[model samples]
Target: MDKNKEKRPSFVKRFLRQTPHAITMLFGIIVLVSVLTYILPAGSYDRVLLNGRNVVVPNSYKIITSTPIDFLGLFKAIPLGFKSAADIIFVVFAGAIMFAFMEKSKAVENSVGTLLKKMGFGRKHLLIVIFTFIYGFLGVAVGYENNIAMVPIAAVLSLALGGDLILAAGISVGAMTIGFGLSPINPYTVGTGHKIAELAMFSGYGLRSVLCFIALSSMAYYNVRYFKKITKNPEKSLGKGLDEEGISLSKPIQEYSVTANNWLVLSIFLMGLAVIIYGVFNLNWYLIELSAVFLIIALLCGIVSRMGATLMSETVLKAVSLAAPGAFMVGFATTIKVLMEMGNIGDTISYNLALLLQDMSLYTSAISMAVSQSVINFFIPSGSGQALATLPVMLPLGETLGLTRQTTILAFQIGDGISNLVNPTLGGLIAMLAMCRVPLDRWLRFIFPMVLVLLLMSCVALIVAVATGYN
Candidate 1:
C-alpha cells in the first residue's frame, strides 16, 4: 500500500461539505409541509370575489373533510407548482434576457461607467444614494422578485465604483427589501392585503410613504458606512471571497465609451419604464403584462444596438441558460404553498394561531400578527399567497380585538416584506445572492443588524397605525 495515497472522503462528509442547493431545500420544505397535513386537521374559510379577486370571508372558517397528500399526490405537486408559478417564472426569464441583451450591447456598462466618472471619486456616496433610490422605486412599483435579474449588473457596477459585493447587495437587494416592506402601492403585498381586508386600494399611502422614506434613508446610510469601511480596508469585507469570483465587467471602465447609441437605448429603456408604470397603475397589469413589456424593450434594444438577428438570438439563449436554474427555483418555492393547500392544512394552522391570539391585548395581538406572518413567510414567500391564506383569519381576529382592518394589513405588510431579506426559503433573495456568489451564511451575518433596525421601526409603525385609527 502507498503510504502517501490520498484517502477519498466518505459520502456523508462530501454531502455535508456541499451547501444545500436552493431547489433541494425548497423540495424538502414541500415534503415537510405535506407530512404536516396528516398530523394537522383540515379546515378552510369561505372565499368571495371582491374587486375581481378571491378573498377569504371573515369568520367563515370551518373544519372540512381531510385531504392529506399521499406520496403520489406529493410527487404530482411538483408539476402543479410550476404551472401555478409560470407567470413569475417567465417574468424572471424575460428580465434576464433583456438585461443580457443590454450587456451584449455594452449599453449598461457604458452608462454605469460614464455615470461614475461624471460623479467623480469624491462624490461616490451620492452614487450609492441614487442607485438605492432607483432599486427601491423598482421594488415599490413591481416587486423585489422581479428585480433579481439586476443583481449581477449591480455587482459589477459596485465593484467598478470602488465598492464591494456586499455594497452591491445592499444597494440592490437591501434597498429593494426596504421598499417592498414599506411600499404604498406594491400590488403584490399592499394591494393584495388591502383587498383582503376590504379596504380601498392604496388608501393609506400618506403614512406608507413616510415609512418608506425613513426606512430607505436609514438603509442608504448603512450601505454608505459599509461601503466606506470596505473601500478603506478590503480585507475586512464580509464578502471578500466574492471579489475573487470575478463577477465584474469583462472590459475595463475606460473601454466602455458612452456613445449616442447608448443614450438612445437608455432613453428607450426609460420610456418603456414609463409605459409600464401607466400599464400597472391604470391598466392593472401584472406579471404577464410586465414580462411582455420587458420582452418588447429587449427587442427594441437589440434593434438600437444594430445587432444581427443571429447575434441577438444567441445572446438571449445564453441569458436564458444562465437564468434557467433561478427560474426553476421560483417554481420550486411555489410548491410549498401548493403542497400546503393540497394537504388542506393551511387554514388549520391559521385557525389555531388565531385562537392563540384571541385573548391578547390589541397591541400584543398586532405585534403577534406581524411576528407570526414573518414565520409563515418562511413557507409561503409569495406576498399575495400569504395574504390570501392568512388575512381571513387575521382580519376577523383583529376586529374582535378592536383593531382596524388597516392595522391588520399594516402588520401583514411589515411581516411579509421584511422577512424576505433574511428568509433562506425566499427564492428571489437566494437567486440574487447566487448571482453575486455571496454565501447565505455570510449575508445573514452582514445583514442581521439592519434586519433588527427594520423590525424595530416596523413595530413602531404598527403602533402608530393602531393609535391613529389608520383606516
Candidate 2:
C-alpha cells in the first residue's frame, strides 16, 4: 500500500468525486451557479449580487432575462476582459521564453549542477524541498517571475539527477504559486481581494505570509518523504527512463553553440526582464505592447547569428500561440463574473449562507464563512472578484455574529489562494502543468494533502480571530 494514501474520504474528496467528468469542469459549475443565483429567488433576503456599486434586489427577473448574450456582444466583451488579464499572460509568456533562453544557453543547468556537486546535495528529495521553500519565499518577493524562471531549472535538474521530472517541476512551480497565492503587493490576487472587500490594501498581508509559510513547509515534508522512498529503492519509486531496456547512462548532453546562441539568448533575457519589471510596477500597457519590439530584436539577432528568419519567427509565433488558451480562460472567467453580477449570484450565495449561520456562535460563523469562501471560489476564481462579490454580504453577517470583518477577509484570501493550486481553469497552473507533462491526477495526489492542511490551518487561524475579536 502507498504510505501516503488516506483510508477515509474527506468532504472535499467526496465533492470532487461528484464533479462533472469534463475537461473544463469549472465552466460547467459556473453555468450551474449562474442559474442557482439568478433564477432562484432569495426567500427572505434583501440584496442580490452587485453591478458596479448598486445592490441587486431580488425579483429583478426582467433584468436577468434581458442580459445581452448575443455572439457579437460576447465577442466584444471578451477582449475587454482579456485586456484586464493581459498583464498576467504577458508576464507568464515573456518569463517562460526568457528562462527558456537561459536554460538553452546551459547557464542555469551548469550553475545548479556545479553548486549541487560542490555541496554533495545528491539527496534529491532534501534538495528539492529546500529549493521549494526558497522558491515559495521568493515567489512572494519576486512574484510570478519565479514560475517562468525556475520551472525549467527544476525540470533540467531532475533529469540530470535521474529523478522525477514531474517532482522537480512541482517544487519550482508550486513555490511560485505559493508566492502568487500570498502576494503582498501584486494587484493580480491579494491587491484585487483588498479592492473587492474595500479593506486596507495591506490588511491580509501578515496572515497570508503565515499561511504561505505553513503550506510550503507541508509541501516540503511531502517532497522529502517521496525522496526517501525513491532513495530506498531507486528503480521502483523513481521508475525507469523512457529508454529502459539495454540503456547505459552515457547519453550526451545537448550543447548550444555560444556563437550561434548568444545574441538571441541575450535579447530574450533582457526583454523579459524589462517586461517583468514593468508588470511589477503596474506600468502602462504600452510596456506589454513593447514585446513586439523585443520579438523583432530576437529576430534580428537570430538572423545575424546565422539563424533563419523562419526559425525565429516560428519560435516567437509558438510562444504567442501557447498564450492563446490562457487569454481565452481569462475572458471566459470574466464572463462568469459578469453573469454573476447580472444575476445577483454573489449576494444570493452570501446572504443565504450568512443567514443559515447567523444563529451560530462567533467562532462558528468565522469557520462557516471560511468554508463558504472556499465554495464561492469555484464559481469566482478571481480572488478579487470573489472578495468583492461575497464580502459585502459576508461582512455584514460577520458583524451580526460578532466576528471581525478583517478575519473574514483573510479567510477569503486563504480559500481563494488554495483553490488556485488545483483549479483547472487557473491559466498559470495549467501552463506550468503542461510544461511539466504532469496530469491533473498526479498533481492532485501531491497537492491535496497540502490543501487540507492549509485549509484547516486557515480555519483555526480564523477561530483565533473570533476569540480575539480581530478586525
Evaluate all candidate structures by whole-model CA lDDT and list the values in order: 0.78, 0.57
Candidate 2 per-residue C-alpha lDDT over 1-471 given as tens digits, one digit per residue, 9 for 90 to 100: 865566667777666555442235545645564456535553323444443443323233222332433445444544554565565556446544444334334445555555556556546666777788877876777655324544656666665565664566567777677667755565655665455557787764665667677778877776666656666777644233422111111233333223435545555555655665565557534325444443444444455455465665565556555545444454455555555554455555655665687788777777777777777775566555565556666666676777666777766666677777776545556556544545444566556766777678778777766677665
Candidate 1 — which pairs collide? none
**Candidate 1 residues 1-471, lDDT tens each?**
765456776554454445464455667777888889899889888988866667777778899889989999988998987898888778778887777777777777787777766767678888889888888888887766556556767887788787887788888888888888779997888888776777899998888898888889888899999998887888868776553333456666566678898888777777887787787678877778878988998999999899999999998887787667667766777777688778888777767877888889878888888998988787677788788878877887788899998889888888988888888667667666655556665666677778889889888988888888888
Instruction: Return the top candidate by TM-score.
Output: 1
TM-score of 2: 0.71
After superposing candidate 2, which stretches have Cα over 4 Å from the reference?
Answer: 1-104, 121-123, 144-150, 183-208, 230-271, 282-306, 314-347
Alpha carbon RMSD to native, model 2: 6.4
- The lDDT, on a scale of 0 to 1, for candidate 1 is 0.78
**RMSD to truth, every model:** 6.5, 6.4
